[model samples]
Target: MRKTIWKSMILSTLAVGSFAFPVPASAAVQVNPVPGLRQDFIKGADVSMLPEMEKNGAVFYDVDGTKMDELQIMKNHGVNWIRVRIWNDPKYGVLGGGGYTDEQRALELAKRAKAIGLKVLVDLHYSDGWADPGQQYTPHAWKNDSPQKLEQDVYDFTRKIVQDFRQQGTLPDMMQIGNEVKNGMLWPVGKLPAKDGGKAFFRLMASGLKAVRDLDPDHKIKLMIHLPDGGDNDVYRKFFDMLVKDNGVNDFDVIGFSYYPFWHGSLQDLQKNLDDVSARYGKEVVVAETAYGFTTDNYDQEKNHYGPAEARRSGFTATVQGQASGLRGVMSDLAAVPDGRGLGLFYWEPDWYAVPGAGWKAGSGNNWENLSMFDQNGKALDSWDVFRDVSDETAPVVPVTVTEMDEPEAEGSTGIPVKLPQSVLVTFSDEHQEMLPIVWKDSAPVYDKDGDYSVSGSVEKIDAPISCDVTIKPKANLLQNGDFESLSLDGWTVTGDKWTAQPTSGKGDAKGEGSLHYWGGTPYQFTMSQEVMGLTPGKYTVQVSAQGKEDSSKFCLFLIGDNGEKKTAEISTTGWNQWRTVKIADVEIKNGKAVVGVDMKGAPDKWGSVDNFKLYRQEDSKAAK
Candidate 1:
């Protein structure tokens, strides 16, 4: 669930905050340097879309408005390494277009990095498109290959790639065998948690490792094993333990973690996991990928991946300064790694600013412009100063105290528990500050009656206690048992096979204590519905948390009014346990009675789970229309 390259790139096409000219250079934030920063620390960027972007009229400029090559601009701003993704055959993509990360494109980027004196890290996805914890469809050409044949193909294909790089005089400085192989790669044959899947995955990984080693007998290029969920120590421990002790396939130079603060966890969680895994496996740890949004504007029909909710989780605002602080926090965490086992980090796709005619595929919008290091006009943002200032090693800003820190506050409907901020921004005596995690006395506070409540909390670095003020208004949800905490569908009308209730303690996609689960040895279609009576007639919206394994299955959240009015919102799932919220909004409730539920038509051997069905008045709902 780390990411989908295609989906992330297909953002929004509409221009936002456009200007007749570039922003002034003075608009960038200038910061003092970090103390004792390492000279060889990896300040990297994954600008794989540079070729496509430039080809489609994208122009890069410095803070001073001087036009320059994107790679050159990155190098000037302290980026010393470039990461490029290589797809086997993008022409076979499901979208029926040439994938942008083919060998030629990757090699071109590598050459550009080399020309600018920057090191290169080659990321091999193995598949023709995106490969992550969720989906890992094998390359179409190798679809019919057996395990033995697949192993041979991996070796041959990898060897040829390395050879091509060597011939071009742009051999990558480091190579990742596979991209984010947390749940393993190459689909069912190598999918993890299965009976024999681990063995098959190890074999395939070993084959790729052999190719890199053979091509680099001198061992000039470092090798790495990359995975998602950087803050989850258990995931790292189990995966590495199995690879090292059980299968004996631990021949790698680095352990790479893709940690996006919002998706992974707090900065404290990241530091703890990095410290543990680096010590446990005795390998160098590098944050392979990370990024934060500088703004929340969606600009078009495409919704941004990072917003207020994600920002709150990280204890940072969606602002230019917030973006800088987030990256600085990451750098500080890595710097604190014991024995200097922590290497450095790479910002994913910093150059992928929104522009017409350039996206993940033809006619697709860019959903990640808010997270780009460049603005809509390709002007370098003030946050880029973090890299420049850190690399310069000018001076350090000391934090003396947090007397001027801001208190936390939020509001929510009575039925649902108000989500307190996980972290808080602490301003110090010198006015230099950072966002730190908060340890609350009462972590979960749910109020049945409408009123205001305060939860006391303490910051790890601050001795003084703080309180978060929450305003709980009247309940907005019109239905009951929506969170599935009852461990059964007591209020839901069930159809098809009997479903299982999964507890939150497990790895199921339940956001609360329990969720509705469905799957069997045979194919099936089912519905878990609820009819709510006596609703105030008006525009309404329903939101449900759900995930599934079948990409072809038609899973939808639907609503029907008493007068036969109907509406449906399709749920698009990336993987079995990677949950996402799906909602049908702006339903005019002409009658007092309305029925809503999940209707799933799953294929044989496929599975899915759902939880947290909430019905809110249209004005109170946050779901995109």
Candidate 2:
């Protein structure tokens, strides 16, 4: 979701609550009251490819064009923590394929991060390759082991890794027992809904947790259980509920989630989910993996994974400005968590530039080059500004009370003025001198054709910025079966050979019975169009949730006018497995009938799908102006 950072001046009356104090035994005694402060928000990055990029002749430079050590550069950008991932045994073993994050390689990286006074977060995949919601393969050596033996192996391996770090005096400050294990880990033995009575999954996780606790006798290392899809509260609630209540496993310090905006949901949804999970579990939460593309243009001949298409789907342009804005939105959301239970965030692989010989697998050069904080040329991008101005120490004290005294009034007639809240009285203690008053800057006016209209005010404080959300209920959707939950292409007219109804994959719509999948055919052409009639539209927005299979494919949403004119908005394939919203705004539907649909072309090897095609007729309002 696109967010605006508003700056406004505030004039407010201060109301202070009176308190009675009891005298201490010694009037001259100096005492420090308990600090009513949140933990220092962590700003971190996963530069697992730092060593490989540096070794492959990639030189990093600061914004001023002066060359510096990469670690120092990150440190200079307000980065206080670094994360490194470790695979059990890569295909070519440790130090092969540009040091593919084996145990030793991870330790080296951790030591380097520590050398610069950066805390380390260790991510253990427990597999040879990637381990996520879709796939979590067991190590080759333990693939054939029995359930009991695999649990033992998990304990042994975790303990050994922790021991190695402890002996080197570089134990990680935080350790993720598993990386994005949404479906559980260790494949068949410990997979979710475990065939063997669901005990194996918890046993494996318990083993890992025990190993961390046992190896670090001092209990300095914080343990985190990570899962992907940070916006899905159901996934987190169900998984953790099962793990803790049903499976009897509940010893973890932090709840980590991977939240790539394109793949996940909007920033608002993420904020809601984080708030719910934090309040429900009463545990610290962190966005373990997040990144935005700086540019859609490829810097190297090697196929870039996150290109222009991916950037569009990410709801941000593939520009340095977009990267900074996206990161700012994410960080702001993380910091807005109620009671400050939101710990912080980590940008995944911010240093993985498109350097030769530094690829995920053999010949698959850096797919995440565009998402790095540094440019393809190894020059730091403007995104580092997110880390430059660290202000955790300066956050204003929480307000005691901020109440909306009066609701805004808007007349139904045209040219009628709608009165909105001008200011709010803020109550705070005398110590909170730096706390600024809340001011109304702008508001989103919601208007429905059915005569339901409301306005949401946007407020902001300069010093300690926080989101002030005003709920506005939206109008009903104009299009039928927008979610495609009927399991049939009842309203859509499918053209070309590849459009078919299939089960929805990835995230986006709760009613996931079916979706329209369009595979690029031999001639590379496909379209799914739906006609919506009976609409008096001045302006409308066409939105669809979609995902693609490869970066080369183009998925577009178009509004076809009655006279053959078309307004189109398209997103290139990005996070193909993760669903994202594609929206075309301000579409002037002159005629009552307009054809709304998606078109797929180019890159026959790739396929794309869409669901939840919604059309909303925007009401003419003064607030919208």
Candidate 3:
């Protein structure tokens, strides 16, 4: 319980830190030059070597121009290693797929890294498409093989790949036999160590491990057993112990875990799990895949895969500040480990920001960019600054992995649930953009797509620098999935709210004004720097506004408290469309900043645009009482 209080305090501090400080507009963060260090763990990033449009087609994406220059950037961020995956006979969805094979893109990137003193870790997937525990289709060449034949093939393929890389001076410092092999590779013969006491999987893994050892038997190369979901130590224990029980597979090097907050548990849980695993097995541990989000709402919903709540519970606030804080938490936990067993980490696809055609969606771009290390325009994020030295003595300038726990919790309960608040009508409206003016609610509202309110399924960005709480309600629609969640530009937050540049087509979307802010409900002004502006102490009615209206533009009004719950309101807007105004004649303001923004909930198409808003003192003054 005491530990819980501290974690909560850290979370709260992170939430209010933004509103408390005066942030610079369009500010570029200063990255401290990471001092040269002899790090035991490999600090790397999984930058996909996108199969070139052609052999050398400009590397056309995020090259030096966009900070996509891997070699230099890795060095800058204290990333000393690069992990590249290899696929067999894959067209990668191009001209019958005349793209990079294992010897192509991976080799090229590996060569580049080696040439620049960067270490490489090679991942062998033996399959054409993505191969995890769920889907591990044997490569075409090995599809027709018998169990023994497949084992031999794995040994040969792995040996040949390692030898080839070694000959090219790009030999891997560490090699991952398979990618997320919850179930082992090669299928019926090599699936995960079965719950039914099977030896097929262990034998297959041994085949790969031995092949790696044959080429260079001096333990010069570290071997890592990769698994998805870091929070589940039970999975690791089950998989590893089964492997250990087998006579064929035992001499592995490190335990690699994937730590994705939305999918994995909190870092507290992860650390405890890691501490236990490494101590028991006597192996090093590295979080091979980790990333935190910088934005709560997606700007271009078409591309990217990060739907809301990507990084909320694990103490990551889902804001630029939160991402920074989250990294700090992970690193600090790593530092506290004994024997420095916590090697380091790799930010999974950290460079996956918004490129011209780079997004998560199939038809659109990938949605993972919102959680990328850099912003869409290739700007480095503030999150990088989170990596710091132990005590400002051992090269404080350089990016250090696993410094001491900054605001650590007690032993257990890192994953303990906080009693987050439920949905409350913070603010409501009938027209344009309607949003619940929430401010740092202990927990974001749970408004699902039940087809009632025009809401947004996106999670609340409840961290600092943007501590305002908000939820864009979705509208109900019979024809489609009711994308009625219109965004409001009121109450300290602004989003397209499912409102795009395109024209409205159905019920959910409509032109704005009525939903978000009340046009003349006094005067609710805004300036991002101030959280609670010192208002002239007097009775005042809060006024609001909305944008993107064709004719009689209307507005809504509401006062909101911290955490995004509705506070107070007076009247509503009925008529006055053509750039006109309306009022909700009542209310008062004591002091501090009054958060304001318009909402375009249920608004569709070119729906929910907003601007020109303020807060005014009520005329009732002394007489209203």
Identify the leading candidate in terms of lDDT: 1
Task: Report the alpha-carbon TM-score of model 2 versus the true structure.
Answer: 0.62
Per-residue lDDT of model 1, residues 115-146, tens digit only: 87999999988998878776677899999999
TM-score for predicted model 3 compared with the true structure: 0.57
- Please report, in order, the local distance difference test score of every candidate based on alpha carbons: 0.74, 0.67, 0.50
**Winner of 2 and 3 under lDDT:** 2
| TM-score of each prediction | 0.69, 0.62, 0.57
Q: Between prediction 1 and prediction 3, which has the larger lDDT?
A: 1
Ten contiguous residues with the weakest lDDT in model 2: 15-24
Q: How well is each residue in 467-554 modelled by candidate 2, as lDDT tens digits?
A: 3333222333556456655333444676664322232322332227456655432336667788766555467778888766756656
User: Top model by TM-score, which number?
Assistant: 1
| Candidate 2 Cα errors over 4 Å, as ranges | 1-39, 92-99, 390-531, 534-625
Candidate 1: give the clashing pairs: 10-365, 11-365, 11-366, 11-367, 12-366
lDDT of 3 at 466: 21
